[model samples]
Target: EDQVTQSPEALRLQEGESSSLNCSYTVSGLRGLFWYRQDPGKGPEFLFTLYSAGEEKEKERLKATLTKKESFLHITAPKPEDSATYLCAVQAYSNNDMRFGAGTRLTVKP
Candidate 1:
């Protein structure tokens, strides 16, 4: 069976501080992306993807990388407005829906 486990459930960082969020998975033939929800009533915004093992993608202050066993989302010098719920997901070749982690709720304080 495949699974996705995200660590630290939540994180708090001061403005201009840096940190990384983790998402571990057990799926083979991985294909999915990182998404972020800015508010409770908003939809998740697509941030980036991990098409293959060892692949990495970046957007603005964020960087995402995928490996055989896990993925990481690195944030560099985030501001308070960067606070959001970051999610990770993966899907094998045979599945129609991707498996998602619970999500890491990050709070960047000014």
Candidate 2:
């Protein structure tokens, strides 16, 4: 069975606060791990693509890393504008459709 789970369904952070969200996955064969940021009422915006263990990618205040079993998304000195639902998805060789985590909703206060 392929699956994805995210921790801390919602998080409240003060301005410039740093934190990390976790995404755990189980799949037959991992093709790729994708990270995305989604604003209210809109589709997710791609943030990263981690292909293998120890692989990492970053954009602005966010960074994503992946391993065989799981992945993490780190936020560094987050601003209010950084607040959004962060989603993780996995692409498996066996299935072309992507499986998505419910997402971690972050709220950064000014």
Candidate 3:
């Protein structure tokens, strides 16, 4: 059975603090891994698309990396505006279906 799980369901950080969030997943015939950020009541904004192990992508203060069975989103010196729910989704090749993690809620306070 394929599944996705994110650790530290919630995180609180002071402005300018740095941290990393984890997304663990298991899938048959992996196709890609996606990272997204969603603000309250809003649709998720795409952050990255990782196609294979050792792939990585970055935008502003966020960096996403992927391996065979897991992915990580690293935030460097985040600001209050960075607060949001981070989501990870995986697509499998066989069915072209995507499974999403519960998400990690991050709060950056000043």
lDDT tens digits, residue span 1-110, model 2: 89999998999999998999999999888999999899999999998988899998888888898888889999999999999999999999998999999999999999
Candidate 3 has its poorest 10 consecutive residues by lDDT at 91-100
Give the per-residue lDDT of model 1 (tens digit) for 1-110. 87999987999999999999999988766666455555667977778877777889888999998878888999999999889898888878877887888999999999
List clashing residue pairs in candidate 2.
none
Across residues 1-110, which tens digit of lDDT does each residue of candidate 3 receive?
77999988999999998999999999998889999999999999998999999988999999999999899999999999999999999998888678999999999999
Position 60, candidate 1: lDDT: 90
Q: Report how far off residue 5 is in candidate 3 (Å).
A: 0.3
lDDT of all predictions, in order shown?
0.84, 0.93, 0.94
Q: Which ten residues in a row have the lowest lDDT in candidate 2?
A: 59-68
RMSD of each: 1.3, 0.6, 0.7
Q: Which stretches of candidate 2 lie over 4 Å from their true place?
A: none
What overall lDDT, based on C-alpha atoms, would model 1 receive against the true structure?
A: 0.84
Alpha carbon lDDT at 71, candidate 2: 97
**TM-score against truth, every candidate:** 0.92, 0.97, 0.97
